[model samples]
Target: APDSGGGSSEDSFTEDSSTDVATEDASTLIPPPQLGLYGTLNQLQVDVSRLPRPDEYNPAMSSVEDFQTIDIPSDIKTVAYYLQAAQILPPGEDEIRFSRQEDQLAGGLVRRELDRSIARYAAESGDTATLTMTGEVLAPEVTSLEFYYFDGLAWVTQWDSEMLKGLPQAVRVVITIRPARSANRPEMIGLTNSMTAIEQGDLVYSLVVQLPLAEPPETMGDSAMEAMGL
Candidate 1:
């Protein structure tokens, strides 16, 4: 799939177009494409053994449990894998199943190859980085996840990606900053809560956030917050 290249359409307008035209401009008038409510949810599963601790279960929700949403670049394939597992697997077959032992082995090898590819590209591009934040929310109703970083004066924009279809209500947010090393530094980070609620189907909420490129000052981080009783 191709990225939609997200941004507000307002920037495309030219003041010259406001002039009264002699004839109806066919070029100016065009119809929008048919679109659906949700985009595909890519999934990335964490190996429990590799993880120091397992994710906690959510008691309040049943159908979906605690999950996080992370901000990652759209180009990386691993990001797609993560989105696929968390967002797509559950509904399709309850889980992602390897047909045979050989298949499983092949899948593992493929995964490693993909990881190496991502790392290589990151080294060369220096335009992306990854941050794994804990926790997950129900498939968010937001149109997109935007990564905001704190500047000295105000929160500045870092990155954003469109949410995929079947995004889990709850999924761990493992932000994968592309290029691992990048010129644009991150100062602080947070998620955006800007999403509309679906009137009919499943309730959706977004986890758009702003995160820091560098470690935040003494006032931030979990341990600091704990000390401050935040």
Candidate 2:
């Protein structure tokens, strides 16, 4: 019989080799690790531009010099600005009697300039109801932008003229969004929404946004308006 003192050299060697193979196989079975710092910092880029043109009926107007300003991150998923008929005082001779001259007389003047453009855009895709943006929000270097509506109770959602048919809510709202700034991190900015639910006819706005990251957003200045001769 073989010596019973201890295990053979060949047997020990085999056992060690088995353990090493099992360790390597086990490591291979594990999934790849998730992205960490690199994922956290890098982001996709997007641009947003959804404001009414200067020569249009901007019911959101509060005063002669008052214009809506929407701030967005250079990297933005979406942005929306809303204007409602309720923002304007009640329509009637009496309402006008108490309103400022510059505000009262300018309504039809602005609508005339925008009526055709609004109609054309609405008819472009064989859709009904219409919302058109007159100002440029994207810089010359950027392309690819999307539009949406600013709902009082929800995040931005896809919008079309058909979705607004026959309702005549007289609530005119516009929104814009871009892709995420990075794989995981989205840019964020403030959305200013001012409208009246019912009476008082005063503008009420809220500013809150979460999106992908990018350059700081800025307002479309008077120069942009003058360029269009608004």
Candidate 3:
């Protein structure tokens, strides 16, 4: 790690060799994601234009400035940026190729955001959930990123959109983050997430995201909207 690289961070990530990765016995030697230092969270500045262009949406508005700065919570730990993808036309020629449309096949009306919970369900099945969850506490870059659904009744830690045929009115995203140990760490290693629950620092952050009503078009079938609880 660089001498100036030290902030609040965990140990330096290793450049894993093919031989080392292939050896099961050597895997335990590597430590899970851990917090390095504890300090105030710094403000973040974002460049609007430099961000990746979304699949949809028009660039109707022109930027007066290139970048914008914003203040963040000083006690915060980490941040995870996510994008939900949808396209009118998916890859390749449209028809005769097994219905490769995101809306028709995935059915945004019936399975909003492709039932993001399926991946979580798979991860949290049986004893495996123990492996993924940091359990009673959250650790920087170590705890499982959890989503809680606030159904009309109460907030639930889990949801199956496929089984329910739709999604909740709102969602609560909870997770922790660790700062990059080195400047190049992000490009080289990406954000490190633990496969197993880490018992270390307890740092968590949550934000409530109220979902827009998934209103179907007038021509859309009544069955789907009803299933969606709209």
Candidate 4:
């Protein structure tokens, strides 16, 4: 009488065994690795020591010393004084401008023709003029990366072959002022100066890097437990 239903007991044991096996299988599965993008900008210190000094000279003046006695008109003289002032401005003050976004950036430099102004003043006493400015920009980006600059009229293509990721990059921008072609007819040139009256151009740059998502320690612990069938 006690064994009459023994078959049912065996079936119950089989079902229980199957349920345990399913639980063990679920515990052993590993999770997939996660991936993501990380973006950052690092400010880089610029050393102007290595930059070449403004070398353009006025053919009308024998030497920079002549600038002291030049009989420049009052208006032209004013421009000359301001041009010299631009040079002593604070770092990243009147000389450079920077713009940044999530995936794009831009920089500009302001250049003034100090040499031309001084030279012109030395040549003429009744002439009024403004200094000419041209920008020579040099910025770095990841290799095969493309960027653009406002060319007074529109954005122009700026591309480079330097690739950068997950690390800071340094870009050196050099701005120079050269003589204007016509005397007493100086026109505004180069990047517009936002911080000063001096004509400006830009060579702005920064380092950008991509970083992997940080994996939590608990995630690894759980993965290991599952792998060990714990």
In the range 14-115, model 1's lDDT, one tens digit per residue, is 112211211111111111121111111222221111211122223243211211222222222221221101121224542323122222211100111112
Comparing 2 with 3 on TM-score, the higher-scoring candidate is 3
Candidate 3 lDDT score relative to the true structure: 0.28
Ranking by TM-score: 3, 1, 2, 4
Which structure is stronger by TM-score: 3 or 4?
3
Candidate number of the best lDDT? 3
Say which candidate scores most in TM-score: 3
Per-residue alpha-carbon lDDT of candidate 4 for residues 1-230, written as tens digits (9 for 90 to 100)? 11221122221111211111000011111111121111111111111112223432332542222222332222221111011112122355422221112121122221112223443443354322111222112221111111122212222222111221111121212122323336754333322211111122222122212112222232345544343222
- Candidate 4 stretches greater than 4 Å from native: 1-167, 174-176, 187-230
Provide the overall lDDT of each model, using Cα atoms, as 2-decimal numbers. Answer: 0.22, 0.22, 0.28, 0.21
Steric clash count of candidate 1 = 56
User: What's model 3's lDDT at 18?
Assistant: 17
User: 38, model 4: CA deviation in Å?
Assistant: 20
Model 2 C-alpha lDDT versus the unseen true structure: 0.22
RMSD of each: 20.0, 30.1, 20.9, 30.3
Q: Can you write out model 3's per-residue Cα lDDT over 1-230, one digit (the tens) per residue?
A: 11221223322221120111110111111111231111111111111122323421232331211101111122222221221112223356334422222333211101111112322333344323211111111122322233445555445544444444455555554343443446744321112222111222334344556556522244545553443233
- Summarize candidate 2's per-residue lDDT along 1-230 as a digit string, tens digits: 21111212111211211111000010111111221110000011112334544533344552312211221222211222211111133445353333334332221101111222222343454332112121122221111111222222222323222343211111212121223345764222212111111022212222223222212124435553332222
State TM-scores per candidate.
0.21, 0.17, 0.26, 0.15
